[model samples]
Target: MTALIEAESVKRYYSNASWLQRLLFLGGSEIQAVDGVTLRIEKGEIVGLVGESGCGKTTLGWLLAGLEQPTEGAVRFKGRSLGNIDAETRKKVQLLFQYPRESLNPRHNVRTILSYPIRKMGHTATADITARIHSLLEAVGLSARYADRYSFQLSGGELQRVALARTLALEPEFIVCDEPTSAVDMNVKVQILKLLSDISREKGISLLFISHDLSAVRFIADRICVMYLGKIVEQAPAQQLFDHPCHPYTMALLDAIADIDPNAIRKASLHGQPPSPMAPPAGCRFHPRCAYTEQVGTICWERGPALQPLSTDHLVRCFLYPEVSQDPDRKQ
Candidate 1:
């Protein structure tokens, strides 16, 4: 399948200071929310982006959704540049925020909420608009009867379904789902995920599923990208990443999830929090916390490793592998 969305060396930075205080502070440090990241999503495929909090996952999603433009690179959709697309064309891509309740307008009834997008898209007839609203509600597992009820009357899951219905009203070809299941209960989460999967398969909609939940990503995504400090450390097929993670950071994360063996000695966990993106480490950003840093040496500290091909599709950015095999421990 052709790539429906592609980001090349995308970067986004924020200079932090409230508008009221900006005049007092002459120079505030810039936060590198997303730095030099590249990714591609094929039509009808689900690509999961997994990382810890403050790792730039949400920023990347925003860039792809066109909610925020990249500071550096470009986001392309269906072979056309996002920067060049007209407003109508851009509407083909939608973003579903993490919290459905907070995202919805409290004052509007569900019918008004769902119909708002349709009306904005310029469908004037009341009969046509009502039919579209009903179809969208039914598609997202909500009844048309609930359309007259306000957001406060709905449960968390129901609110989320309404949000989904609203998004579907635009008939978007691609969506950036930023932690869509994070706020709901497990049962509700399962329902949402299943609904998203069914919609994608049936309609051929592409998805960028961003979440901190590795297990959830494994079930939803065909390919996975592991990110650290605004960079993609590893990209592989979902099963390959879970079965054999190459980057030290990726290994540490997987180890953190596994049940600890009672009889075995406890190994040291990854040390130190991620370095500030304002002044990220000179070499490999993860070397400071990596247990395998002994093999990294001066080169790993002096230069960053590029994403090297490990297999047909899997790629990693660490010195332990053959193309970047400067690590003495891996050599031995």
Candidate 2:
């Protein structure tokens, strides 16, 4: 099966410019927001990206959605490069940002928000456009009465639902959900997840769900990928990953969610906070904090590890797991 969206060695860097740059020629350092992230989302599949706050999961999501161009490599949709796709074709992939309250226009009513996307269908009667918006509201579990309501009039969950309604209005083939449930309460979070899962299955729309909540991702994603310091550290079938995490970082994430399953792993604290991407560690980005890294030698401290297959459908990047290392003489 062909991938609905493919990102190859994608990297995104943001340069910092100080006030002195306006006067002098010196430029500030570049922040490595995303570094060498390659991923594929198969048609009709939901892939979850879970990671620390600054690990570039959201940046990768936006890169795959074509909202931002990579500093290197390319993002392709259905074998066609993102740059070659026209506006109409580009609409096939959409991005739902982390916060709906900020993502949605505060001034626009629900009718105006949804109707904006239908305008791409070319000029249509105002009544027909409104009718379409009403259907979208209903589809997102909102009543037609919502059409007259402004974003401020709704709660966080309600606003997110309205945002989802606007997204569905475009009839997109793929959606990148960046922590869509983060702002809502626990009860509402489950409802939102189910709604998204149901909508994906019903519409056959593939989804890239990015979140820090492993349990939620495992519940909603067909496959799960773990990111660390701007790189994907591990990936596998959701159940497989939750059952047997390969990378130390993946294990730490699982351990962090100890409340979910008492027997999963003891509530262990990680060594320290992740290093800044602007000046990442010399070797494996997680080496400074990974307990297993000490089991290995300089190999884990001198060079970064590439993602290697652990099983037929599982991949992990780490030096402790020497069986998957490409370097034949790599330190044990």
Candidate 3:
């Protein structure tokens, strides 16, 4: 079967210099926010995109959700290109931003906020809109009483639920949930994760859960993709990834979530910061911080390795896997 959403060799870049500078042939650096990423999300599958901040997770999410266009490649929904998709088709793909407070209009009450999407996305009568708003609130675990309350009246978790309800109001089939749980407390975070998981299961909504939190991603994602400096370094089944991480960056991210123990022999310890996207490192972007660089030798520095399959399902982009087949941009 065809994937529900596919980003094939997608690339999104930004120029740091003005248009006039480019017109004058003046030199300006290009920031490659997402560089040659090929990803696929099957129907009803929650694919977790895990990486540190500035790794281009949110930028990729924006591209997949059709909020921003890619400089090259294509984002296809089902079997059709997103660019060619009609406005009605576009409504099937929605984005839930990192911050609910910013997404929700401060002046708008809950009823008004939920009703706007229903009215705009399709023609609905005032009475039907009210009924739909109440239904949506209940779907996200919110009560009918919240209809009159503004964003300020809700807690962080409550606000996130409202934001989710708004997204659901569009009746989306695929949602790019960009760091939806980042702002909430631990208890509230668990609740939100459960809510997303439940919603996906019940509604069969394919989700790209982009987050820096490994534990949260592990809880909700069916498959996990580890990103580094605008590229996906590794991807695998969630249980397989957490149990046997192949890439050094993936190891480091998983290690970060573990309890600190001085005596523990960590699989990989990340040092220094990620390189700037404006000018990423020559070879593997994670090479500078990777622990196996010395053992793997100059290959890790001289060339970037293809994302080769370690097992049938797990793929890793590191020279340490010498026996894996050569398929640079192959999709699973």
Candidate 4:
């Protein structure tokens, strides 16, 4: 069966130098933001994409949402190319920006903000638009009284809820939530997560939740994908990944989190900064930071390991599991 959304070996690159500069051997670099990534999101499932900053999480989200085109591959919605989708189908995919204040227009009030998408999309009657605006606000836990308030007048949490209401107004089938809770307080973050999860369940909407917060991802995601630099290092069910993380990067991230035992030693085993995307290492991008690289010898430095299946659903891109048999059904 086809997934609701699929990114097939997509790559998005940005060149800092012009054609003339590159020809002259001048200063130029290519940023491999999203390199050779293949991901699938089933309908109504929340897939959390967790990684450090500059790991291309946002870029991949944009590509998946059809807000940005991939340089090499294609993002498909239900087996159809995003570019070939009609306007109505396009509306089914939406992006929720990380910063709500910046994404919302200060000049417009909450009602106007929510009404614009509705009006432009298909709602022609003022009465229907007004009803939808209020309903969306209510759905996000906002009162109808907030309808007249502008973005500047709202608090950070309120602004985020308003932003979510604006998105919900479109009745999208899928949403790319890019760090939705990063700008809000802890309590508000919980509210946003609950609201998102509830909406996805009630409306059968698929979501790609991008964040560095492992705890949050564990709470809301059915599956988790760990990215490093520009490539996915590991992917598995949320519980499986947290319980038995296969990749060194995933282990380091889990170890770095605060443990319940205050006396327990919990220093992250992984060390060193990530290599630059523009000049990634010759072999595995994470070889320099992986503790097990020495045990693997030059194999870690001379050849990039493919994303191999450790179990039926768990996949890790590393050389530590050379003995594991390749499963054709779960091949990366």
Top TM-score hit = 3
lDDT of 2: 0.87
Q: Clash totals for all models, in order?
A: 0, 0, 0, 0
Candidate 1 vs. true structure, TM-score = 0.90
Worst 10 residues of 3 by lDDT: 323-332
What is candidate 4's lDDT per residue for 75-146, written digit by digit as tens?
999899997899888988999999999999989988888888889778889898888888888999988999
lDDT of 4: 0.90
C-alpha root-mean-square deviation, candidate 3:
1.9
Each prediction's TM-score against the native? 0.90, 0.92, 0.96, 0.94
Query: TM-score of predicted model 4?
Result: 0.94
Instruction: Kindly list the per-residue Cα lDDT of model 2 for residues 52-88, writing each as its tens digit.
Output: 8998998899898888899988999998999789888
lDDT of each: 0.86, 0.87, 0.90, 0.90
Rank by TM-score, descending? Answer: 3, 4, 2, 1
> Where in model 3 is the C-alpha error above 4 Å?
121-123, 260-262, 323-332
lDDT comparing candidate 1 with the true structure: 0.86
Indicate the residue-level lDDT of 270 in model 1: 69
201-288 in candidate 1: lDDT tens per residue?
Answer: 9899899999998878888898999999999999999999999888888887877765767565435456668888888888887877
